[model samples]
Target: MFQETPQDALVGTWTNSLGTVWAIKADGTFQVSLSKNHRVDVWGKYTVTGDEMTIQESHGSHTPKSCRGKAIYKFMRDGEMLTFTKVSDKCKLREKNILAGWKPWKG
Candidate 1:
């Protein structure tokens, strides 16, 4: 049987208004797919400590290798909704995506 951790509640697929699909896994990794085509746009690792999440982009189709920076945000999960408030993020593109927020993906 699979045991659930504190982060397990967040282990699932989430989507934003811009058709971005964010998949957070139990293995401390995440992937982002922009648009309905579902081609992975970004891949990275994330760590959650309490209500805060720190994300570092490892690779992306549109992200440069030199742009690997860690972004920290305070996250809140209210039922089916998930939102982020930036704590510190030097990467503008990444900050934009995080601020956009997400909801549980039904599909």
Candidate 2:
């Protein structure tokens, strides 16, 4: 069971300089926006293990064509800096540390 609900913690707006954003809903519906003003609202069931946050965009209109392009943003940390990444079948590689989404409120 979740000890602390991100419901109160992660329930807010988060953005990256590249224009990607992660807006987490209290109920787990997540919305992500990209650099080109493109966005997808996903049914995101998430899990936080240590510094890693993994969210699967279960139900969204995101196309497979772009799934490997920019479907999701997975965040992790390395040593000190935070990293944002996306998993694309095209690359078959988890792009490492794109950019840590910005949250001024948390700072």
Clashing residue pair totals per candidate (backbone < 3 A): 0, 1
Alpha-carbon TM-score of each model against the true structure? 0.86, 0.47
Model 1 clash pairs are none
Worst 10 residues of 2 by lDDT: 88-97
> In model 2, what lDDT does residue 87 have?
44
Off by over 4 Å in 1: 1-5, 65-67
Report the lDDT tens digits of candidate 2 across residue range 1-107: 75764234555566555555656677656666543555564335655444445554445554243332333444543433344555432322123213444552231
Clashing pairs in 2: 68-88
lDDT of 1 by residue, 1-107 (tens): 98656587678999988778899998999988876888888899989898888886668877754548788888888888888898998777777777886888887
Error of 2 at 10 (Å): 2.6
Task: Report the Cα lDDT for candidate 1.
Answer: 0.82
Indicate the worst ten consecutive residues by lDDT in candidate 1.
58-67
Q: What is candidate 1's CA lDDT for residue 95? A: 72
